[model samples]
Target chain A: MIQRRHALTVRVTHWINAVALILLLMSGLQIFNAHPSLYWGPSSYTGAGPIFELAGGFPSWLTIPGTQWLAMGRRWHFFFAWILVINGLAYLIFSIATHHVTRDLAPTRSDWRSIGRSIADHLRLRHPQGEAATRYNVLQKLSYIAVIFVLLPLMVLTGWSMSPRLDSVWPGWVDIFGGRQSARTLHFVIAWLLVLFFFIHVFEVIVTGFWNNLRSMITGRYRIEHEQR
Target chain B: MASGGVLLSACDAASRNPHVTKVLSIGEFLSQHVQHAVTSRTALAQEFTEADLSPEFRSNGTDYPDSAEYRALAMNGFVDWRLRVDGLVERPVELSLDQLRAMRSRTQITRHDCVEGWSAIGKWTGTPLSEVLALVHPLADARYVMFYSADPMDDWGTRYYESIDMEDAYHPQTILAYALNDATLPIPNGAPLRLRLERQLGYKMAKYLMHIELVDSFARIHGGKGGYWEDEGYEWYAGI
Candidate 1:
């Protein structure tokens, strides 16, 4: 039987987030192409070797402008960044107020105990079926929690730390991240982690009935299959 | 159809790329408004300690002015060089390095964040730009403080220049730095003088400073955008 799964707010925020994240990632790559290097301390320059450096610019297809245009890249990045931040804030506040976090995303004691078994099942490509598929599994809940609470906040903080204007108001942010360059390095590394998560997330959706899963997200109606025990 | 006509009329080829200009304008507007709303106009950029200074503050942009006139001044230790402060001022003044040094000076260690994703901390000593502005007394209508550098940015002899809003120009941290790292400013790092606008990106801090112009608008300046980089599509407000 099919029932309402995602709320309207969730569905709307999800799509907005999808668009914003894609734009952010693409424009961010374009911005990265300007320097293509990351450092650990307060300073980095010609003589000072960077902790990480890309050999060359990303391909045109990968960037926002599809060209080596730094100013344009920055425009796209900042534009979408505001959208991402606002949408994320609204989603976070709404989710917490609605008890979405407590009801679905929070890990229970038994869920914690089942984490090892869940990991093994995931490794073996053993996915939830029938009624089990109706609700999010323990691993899904934990990943969502980590991404929503930890990674997203880190990204926002690191982004803020890079802004000279923001730094003037809150100087300690730069120190907390070790330095501006360190904060930048962390921002890049965490972005890749999110990218990895996105890929895995998509793969999981494809494996577990792509249309049904995607349709549920879009239309807020999910069909729960009944299995004969 | 009416909206389309208006959109078509608004589009200009030289000013922006039609494909991305809409989003760019929105972003610029949002950034300006949000930053101004959230941050105090007089907020001081983060200052570092002597211990926090980088062993080597790598200089970005033009290290030395290539002009023969500038070279002649450099050879004589810039003693002949005079920074002209003119335009929209009650009293125009030409200040030598010695005269600038003689005035009330301030020293602070601050981090320089470049647009190219690098940062360096260095100690700077110089006369507060506010004092210089006071000496000249900028006109009430002067909205921007334009800085002219001796360095030629292109083959056309167009000098590198930058400008800041009157509020930023009067900020306590804004100064014309003459000494770096407890010594005379090096040639490779804007010798004689440079503008230290710590609240903005490195590019906004014009080096090899030669002239300071108080202007009501930047529309008549080179490229009419208020900066060498800003003329070439970089944001005029480099607060980020």
Candidate 2:
């Protein structure tokens, strides 16, 4: 049966988030290519020996400017950063105000208990049947909660810590993250984690039911397949 | 999906074209405005201890001036060198290295964050630019302070230069540094003098300084941008 699934707000915000994150990652890579190294503590420079260094430049296909264009990369990064922050804020406010957080994303005692089983089911490529397909699995809810509440906020904070001016207003942020370089390293790591999540998310969409999930996200309508169990 | 296609195409176009970088300069303008709104005009950059200094502070961009005139000055240990402060000032003045050293000075250990994604800490000693500006007394129309360097950034003899707004100019930490690590400035590190703009990136701190010009606006300067790098696409307000 075809039914309403994602809300218009969710669908719109999801697309906006997807675009923003992609832009951020691309531009971030371009920015990183400017130095091609990551460090710890308050200070780092050439001959200081970075904790991690990316030898050779990131391929043009992956970076925004597609060359060593730090200036242009910064422009792209900062432009989209505002968009990401604003959209994320709107999403957070609307989700909480509409009880979307509590009703859909929040985990319950039963959800916690079912998580282990859900993992097993996911490992076995088992798709939920009938009505179960309409409701989010416990694992889905938990990951969403983690992404929304933890990772995204951390990304924003770490990103803020790297700013020279912002550090003046909130030096505590740099301290909290260990230092500017630490914040930058953490920002890079967390972004990669989000990239990992994106891949898995896409895979899940394809494996479970590509058109059904795609239609739900785009048109707010999902078709649930009825199968004998 | 349709909208996503449109969005992706737009991004693709932006990525492919170099001129798109100019179009995106509006983002820099907006960011600069927002940063200004949030940060206090007099907010100071973090200062560190002597122990925090890097083993080697990397000399960025042009380390030495290739110009023959600058070389002759360097050969004589910059004793004959004078930093000419002129343009839109009540009293145009030229102060030699000795004269600058004689002025009231400030010493602070601070971190220098380069736009190329590196940082290093070093102790700096210099006369506060405000004190020097007070000596010259800039006119009412003077809104920006431009630092012209002796270093030829390219083969074309285009001297490296940078500028800052009046707010940054008057900041306590903004100084004409002539010493590093309790010694005279090294040739590799903008010796004789350098502009220490603590709040901005390394590039904004013009090294190998030779001239100070007070201007109503930087629009008439090279490339009509505030600095050499800014002319090369870097943001003028690099507060971040």
User: Per-prediction interface RMSD?
Assistant: 5.9, 3.0
Q: What is the TM-score of each candidate against the true structure?
A: 0.92, 0.94
> Lowest lDDT 10-mer window, candidate 2 chain A?
A164-173
Report how far residue A64 has shifted in candidate 1, in Å. Answer: 2.7
Pairs of residues clashing in candidate 1: none
Those runs of model 2 whose alpha carbons end farther than 4 Å from true positions after fitting are A45-48, A227-229, B1-23
**What tens digits encode model 2's per-residue C-alpha lDDT throughout A75-177?**
8888788888889999999999999999988888898988889999999999787788888899888788878889999999888777787777744458788
Which candidate achieves the best TM-score against the true structure?
2
The 10 consecutive residues of candidate 1 chain A with the worst lDDT sum are: A40-49
**Cand 2, B chain, TM:** 0.92
Question: Against the true chain A, what TM-score does chain A of candidate 1 give?
Answer: 0.96
- Steric clash count of candidate 2: 0
CAPRI-style quality class for the chain A–B interface of candidate 1:
acceptable
DockQ of 2: 0.49
lDDT of each: 0.85, 0.87
Model 2 TM-score, all chains together: 0.94
